[model samples]
Target: MSIQKPGYKSLYLYLSLSMAPLFLAFTPLQPAYAEEIKNGKQVYEIGCAGCHASGVLDAPKFGNNADWLKREQQGFETLVKHALNGFNNMPAKGGNPAYKNEEIIATVAYMLSEAGFPNYADRTGVKAVTTASTPKPAEKPATVAPKSKPATATKSYKNTNQFNRLMAPSSEWNPPQSKDGIHDPENDGTEMLQKPRVAFEPLANSTSGNRVDWVKALHNGEINPRYDRVNPDAMPVVMDLNIVREVKGSMPNVVYPHKQHTEWLDCSNCHPAIFIPQKGANQISMASILLGQKCGVCHGKVAFPVSECRKCHSQAKTAKK
Candidate 1:
């Protein structure tokens, strides 16, 4: 009907043309934001929030930069794989089977964001930065920052050859780095991977102070030289024996006799230093022991060769059954 012009129609046409610039301005930003994933946060809240939020089972706290900084050095990919496969007490997908891989990746990104790497995935391209430059959180660990050096740019995590994975750094910052932002783990002026493998000299002494040695000496009315020095009168010292029950292993269980050790060395030697003296407190892995920690301190160095497995594992095979 070609009658009088409708005011509302003119108004609608005028508004649409005037607002065209506004639509154009937001068009480019869509992809930038659309690519940035927040799905990880959603999944984390539903699946991982309970444990990670509060650090249950020593789970890295969500926003605790100090807690996640060292772990983040291992690379985002490694973290995702650990989540997919399951790490220690955490089940795969945080025990939620419904989560997808993308969700897990997003969850990891969310964790990194809270740890100080805001927009971690987009900035790092889901890869570790090729620098020792660590991101610092607004709030930091309660302890004082390293007085020796500050975070630098340029470090590599390519080696991935850490022998011990269970133990993470706590309350110490050694600054395992050089001025150029290089981390030579050996500290011997060589690259991480270029460093020579750990070497051990041939067994210097086959005798690892076995039970048999102690028994034979006692039967013949002789005592260990170290003990002999302590007790010249041949009087036995009163011992508060603590029998260590070894968990299942490749060899027979070991029955650690505290009485035997105390006879030669004082309580100070092992208490709170080499051994924590608490049940299950010591994560004594054979790998670390061979590297000269725990019993390896004296066992292989001076006392005896670790080759003498039967020395500590005194229980007969038949008895274990």
Candidate 2:
């Protein structure tokens, strides 16, 4: 025999025997890397944490197996459908419109896993099977009944509170009269003539003074009145002095609505000339407008007749105590 120094077959057998245990140790760990619950934690943190974290607005708290189990009994598919479509206070996709359906399912799985239900996939799979078994029949659309001809009653529908207030003929329908020569029937209302002119005087005086014509004070930049330009598009139609009297003892600066006047005029009608772009510039006085400076510019002439004292100074007509 030619002294073979350890043949190749013997070397191969020895190497295989040495590494067998190492291979056995890592084989069980392969599935862990293959199927990881991905982006589930991120989705939960951004979307579910808000209501679920604290049980806000009566939402179910996170990690509470009892709460989640109760919801689970409704079936995972039903719950998922609710989450996708929104149920009551819980907005759809938890109010994140951009979340994909796969992302939603993954997030639901993660939440279920965290709530001690690690076998979420098996449970959801069973739920899907059961849902598929009880197939619902397709619904037929409801047939619309033919519309009947409208009733010929002369009386209007009286269902609404608004109709109660407005539809009835006025017990007193007095036509408005003019001192000069301009009257519109559309403008013939107590609010247009009386309420607007009267209610806002005290609020005007709180900022300026009694002698100052309230309308002139607003136009001349004596009082910096703020208004709501938002919904219903509020303007200072008339300022109620009672509002001034209500808060005047505690807070000295409250202006009333000269709101109604602006309904007839444009923004440029009073801006720049009446109010400075830089706040707190105009200093107004009653004597100034009476001499035709600030409010006197229009109040006694084109806007309304300011000669009537009771118009602005009328006290709240108290019931005889």
Candidate 3:
């Protein structure tokens, strides 16, 4: 005796098989969603963390619900579009054009999930596409050290060619004087120093180079820095000459404007000392710059860090007709 087939069961079976293609048409297939999130995290750590992690230029802070509230209201797809294109101070794809749309979407999803809104990714209809282009996250080194045997008494050789770790985590960016690694934390005067954010609040904002547009700030009269310490009456001799340096490779040529420098500094600050007065007299390279010579003397030290390539390499290479 065969059991009577239910109408609902028959309808369900029919719909499951017949509508499979239709359902898939609307829904994007994201088989490796977990992998995509992992890749997204890596991408964020490398690039997005620079601004998002710290809320630089009013960017929504990573994992901060308050900062992301308005952004989250716009929906995931809208946020994705903003990231792919450009939003306010943030450049397209976080200023890295090489990043794929898939990676950027995944990154947005990852950020939303951390910001107390995990369902936004699902509401968007299109799941983030995973790509192999995203670099793998580095593995954590072993915390336990190896057991030492009997040690022979000898003079240890110190490595003098060690390089400084220029790339710091977002948490360290513009840290308080007491907490900042550069200052002596134990010193009594350390805590008295004003935080960079508080001091820089009145200054004009910049996307790069210490996050403060010094030249723009000076131009707008937000900051009137003294040209000389001894002579308070001395004024800056602001030259408007622009020196263009031809750079080899795909990078843009360097446009060094004397006007910006002279606005705050004197001629003796660089001429004949840091850079030779005569043209072609001093040989300069990235190696020398990294070693705190030439442009690097002021760049990586007091000005913007050397990592900001576009700050100096502003002149786009003219297309060869």
Candidate 4:
């Protein structure tokens, strides 16, 4: 070798610079990531776990390799941003307003770790912090849901208890007035209507989907049972059907026209499920209706507003001209 004084050489400098990048590459990235994941686990268990754990509404299931992998492909930052701001059918903060940006970030990290990233799952970050899930002594396989029973065909159509509660807000009618005299922000009708949604398409036909106009449409032959599957040609239309309540009843007895509703909807739509065919068989309550239970099912939703009290309270003096 040629004798030379030891000094900074280009080769040595290049190697030194290269080593810097290598060192940085090995630096632990797990600290902050681990912290976020821990926090994320807590937030997710409280707010997100309900739907996400079971994949309700198609929420990404934890440890569901496919759903998590697909979400991961979208980029981790993007996923966090979406959870913070709500995406698609998910309402903002997954419908939990209390979750702050930090809480949401942590929740997202925890979800990702459970999905696939082992570093996030290590739970080795920071000195001391409350963990979302307790560390188990041994890792256990995830519980797989049992297969559902095949539904047997029923004799008549019966609605689930949550029948109309699942409907989108009716655009046709104004939101119900709150006790405070302000427009109630919650549709209080559908959990989905934290914000107003598009109204259901107008019944059969008339000018718009207005119920009054729909009734008029039935009176005229503008629309017909020509379309109804149950009664293709009007079965004996029960006209002037009056439901008279007890004399001491707080509100006037309702005058229901079978001719009108049967005109648009199938009989199974209201039968034993919503309204039992027998009179006085079901207890009708104003509180329940206002809560969108009984008559509130249609009024103020797709048909008309209960505010028009005179419309249904059409017994004797209370009858509208």
> What lDDT does each candidate get?
0.53, 0.46, 0.63, 0.52
Cα lDDT, model 3, residue 225: 76
Model 2 over residues 254-319: C-alpha lDDT tens digits? Answer: 242345456345546656786453434554433344446555666555544445534443444333
Residue ranges of candidate 2 with Cα displaced over 4 Å: 1-38, 121-321
The estimated TM-scores of all candidates read 0.30, 0.30, 0.45, 0.36
Better of 2 and 3 by lDDT: 3
TM-score of 2: 0.30
Q: How many backbone clashes does candidate 4 have?
A: 4
Per-residue lDDT tens digits for candidate 3, residues 170-289, read 444576875443466567988888889888889998756667988788899898777788886778888999988887678898998998888877899899899988766766666457
TM-score of 3: 0.45
What is the C-alpha lDDT profile of model 1 across 1-321, one tens digit per residue? 111243658645655654576566553323112222225555566678878999998899989999999889987767766776566766666754334344455577778987898757443223222221232211221121222212211111121233432222222222223322234333656444322111112112223332234444543445335345666566446465766556455677677777667666777888889989888887664544555888888777755558877768887556546
**Candidate 1 residue pairs that clash:** 40-106, 40-107, 131-154, 131-155, 132-154, 132-155
Candidate 3, number of clashes: 0
Candidate with more favorable, higher TM-score: 2 or 4: 4
Cα lDDT of candidate 2 equals: 0.46
Q: Write the per-residue lDDT of candidate 4 for residues 1-321, one digit (tens) a residue.
A: 221343448435655665576555532321222222235565576567778999987898977878888888887567755775567645555654334344455566677788877665543222114542333211211121111111111100121232442333334243323211133334464444432212323334322234345566567655454653576664543444556554334566567767667656677778889889897786665544655776778865787667766567777645443
Using TM-score as the measure, the top candidate is 3
Residue 313, candidate 2: Cα error in Å is 49
